[model samples]
Target: MSQFKPRRPATGAAIAVLAIALTACGGPGGSQDEGAATLTFGVQAPPNSLDPAQLHDGTQRYVWGSLYDTLIYSDNEGELQPAAAESWEYSEDARTLTLRLRDDMTFSDGDPVTSEAVRVTLERTRDTAGPQQNNLGAIESVDTPDEHTVVLNLSEPDPNLLVALAFGSGVIGDPDTIDDESTALNPVGSGPYVLNREETVDGSTYVLERRDDHWNADAYPFETVTVRAIQDRTALFNALLTGELDAGTVDETQAGQVERAGFTLQRVDGISVGQIVIADRAGEVVPALADVRVRQAINLAFDRQGIIDAIFLGLGQPTTQIFNTLSPAFVEELNGEYEYAPDRARELLAEAGYPDGFTLTMPANLFVQQVQPTITQALADIGITVEWEPVPAQQSGQTTNWGMYFNLGAVAPPSRTVALYFEESGSQNPFGTTDPELDGLLEDLAAETDPEAANGIYREINAFAVENAWSAPIFLQSTNWATRDGVEYVGTANALFDIRVFALSR
Candidate 1:
């Protein structure tokens, strides 16, 4: 497990004195009783809904992570570890998965966690029309052979099945209360913590108390876990400085301030990719986007390093592909495929029969407000005009009014990324964009069983996407987390934050 280390103080008598003073007070949050530790974590937003089906990634993970236990979980090293499920096995054909549960596990309400409960939760997540429903699309049916055994029958070989289960798709809840209206606010699970509904104020703060009788109590060391919704970056920074928050995320620009305040700054790189998605590839909304040269021109028009330096405060690395750097599909050479060249972009536009350039409409939302000016200026340099349409941040990505839009797509394994973005039924493929060659590659990847061979196919798909200029990816975004003196947080490479990753450093 990775541990946060204090940064060396800059050379200055006053600075050294302040660092010494902060260190003497046991860091920002002050000293705490190790035996009765309380971890107060702050997130940018509250969960949309407490229902497992309705819950999405990001802040929602901070909630569902404590309220429930997944069948399997990824450890600090990104390896799948047994959680509620003691062990799991795949069939020879890789089409069926068998899971064995720990008989000692029981829900907070004292109901035994049997195969029935697992089946119910998995089936509900699969059948529901929610964000994670498509993650389990490979499951054809769920079969319970015995009280402790559950079998998953897959329609095809899913290489990402285990990883998906380690995420939201594998969250197990009490079967009896799953459909109850109150369960949405009060969840009962066999996890290490139980929601303290009385102390939890919806949309503001959620309090979770430790369950001593939990099967794996050692995995979660906090006696109490409080997750607060502090959307404003300034407020979050203030809370961390004043010791109101034991741990919280901050913007890249504030890393120096946080480190100077005697807080351990943890960075997990390439968790997501900041990019412009050209959803309407058919040019149904923007006639100019239909040509391959036009898309290539857009890709070449952006100064990725300049954007990273200005907007991200030089905390990110420029990239030309959407795949995460840690993914097996990532090609090192692809990073330099599209260099910042406005002259080349203009040439491509002229070759595509639009020498005078064209007008492209994009959404204007608070989420992308910071980078809008830079984006507009970059495209303008290439003779393209941008018309921004004001829309609510929540409705911008869902609507088809704009031909292109800015988004931060979460980085996952190659297969999961493809299923979530490249597939016809994918969320990012809102217009059902399809390519016969890419479709063939995906089909082959699904049927392949060998890990090495599968990875080779993943690289091919990644290269194809970049070569075709399917989207204009700017850079691999980084996430920062600051923790107090006694709190040790193990960062996960993925986008979601797991509560189990925290431990009190007594």
Candidate 2:
């Protein structure tokens, strides 16, 4: 293994100071004991609204997930599972999906969760013009035949409908209160928890009381779940160490220190990877990146393994494909061809008519900052230089399509991941690097229904993407969750904390 020490030791010192400063503030939870009946969780993202339809970000999804139940859910293996809907079946043409809602389900306000409610909730979601409305664009219409039966009519044969529903679009809100703007702050749903409006702080802390009358009450162990917004990594670590939080997500680099501090750490293989999105592939902003050879050279320039070992502290796996290993579209064979080779990278640069190299600017984030040094040195070795343009994490979305942006997000199926970038109207593709060949492949993949044939076609797309070096696939990130001993919890491949399954020590 190649050794590389980071140039910034100040970051390390800041973390140490924050950890020590927490002790001076006194132990966390003055009245809330360590092993109390209530479970307090430290969340990095806070919910902007309680309404599920209005939510778009992962943090909001977690909070909304607690406040509402979805029609369907995905198991650890990514298979569709039932939630509010007891059973579902697809038509032979794959254009229609029928669902059977449970008769026992009821919203916190005592209103029955019926098929009509499903129609209304979904229709309202589309009409609201919120962030999640686009996810439901495939559904042409929703039909409610009876009190417990819902049938969805599709505009086209979309295989990703179930997966999208199993995610944010599937969350069911109470039809009675969904239209009210107050619902954004005080939500009522057929879920395990009800918001304790008196104790809950709008942006800082959210306290939820368990509903014993919920349909799946037996599955939820915590009587009360408290989600606190602690965006700062240092604050999260301090909270975990001082007993302010019973369970909280941690950065992988800090996992060992958290465990050494007497907290139990659980790691899950994430469906997300860290990558650098070269949005300006058309050379609109950076003239040199337009050449495919320059792009390939950029891919070959990074010493992935060395950065993984030194910068990530051996917590990450190097990758060449953007899709997670578990994704059906991910081609294992394609991952090996693009190993780090500086000499070959230099050759590619020379072949692209940039023997002297060229400089480009990229947006910086925490992850970018960590790997920037290695990237700087590796590119310099290949006669290339990069200038990082600083962008705050919260404001990073504005930087997309500007030049290049750091993309560290969860990987879904091909339809949501790979095809999402290549499709003509794809949301993720804003730079407009249009290729007739790539566009045709994406269209074919979308229309194909056979799993075997689809996977084969996807393999071609994956290989082509790697050969072109569309983006620099860094690694499949390992997410860490810290909990006190005796807390029974399991991390998920999807990276969502299913607090309904969490149980305290008896």
User: Against the true structure, what is each candidate's TM-score?
Assistant: 0.88, 0.82
Cα lDDT tens digits for candidate 2, 1-506? 11112233246677556434432332222233332356788876577677767765454565677778888876656666678887787777777888888899999998989998889888877666655666677788999999999999988766567776777678788887887888899988888889899999987899988787987765555667889987777898889888778888787667878788877777766546777666667888787878888888878877777887777666667898877777777777887877888899889888989988987776776446656777778778898777777764433332333566667766666665653455443444556567878877866766787778988777788887888877778787766778775454564665344564355533
Give, for candidate 1, the lowest lDDT window spanning 10 residues.
Answer: 1-10
Per-residue lDDT of 311 in model 2? 72
Candidate 1's error at 111, in angstroms?
1.1
Question: CA lDDT of each candidate?
Answer: 0.80, 0.72
Query: Candidate 2, overall lDDT?
Result: 0.72
Question: Which candidate should be chosen as best, given lDDT against the real structure?
Answer: 1
- In angstroms, how far off is 392's CA in candidate 2? 6.0
Candidate 1: stretches off by over 4 Å: 1-30, 359-366, 387-402, 492-496
lDDT of 1 by residue, 1-506 (tens): 11112235246686556434423433225454434667898976676677777667655688878878888877765666777787888887888898888899989998989999999988898888877787788899999989999999999887777887877888897899998888778878777888898999988799999888887665565778999987677898999988788998787878888899888877888877888888888888888888889999999998899888888887778999988778888999999889999999999999999999999888887557768998899999888999888875333363467778887766776777787668876767767789999989988987787779999999998898898887899989887889987777776665357886665543
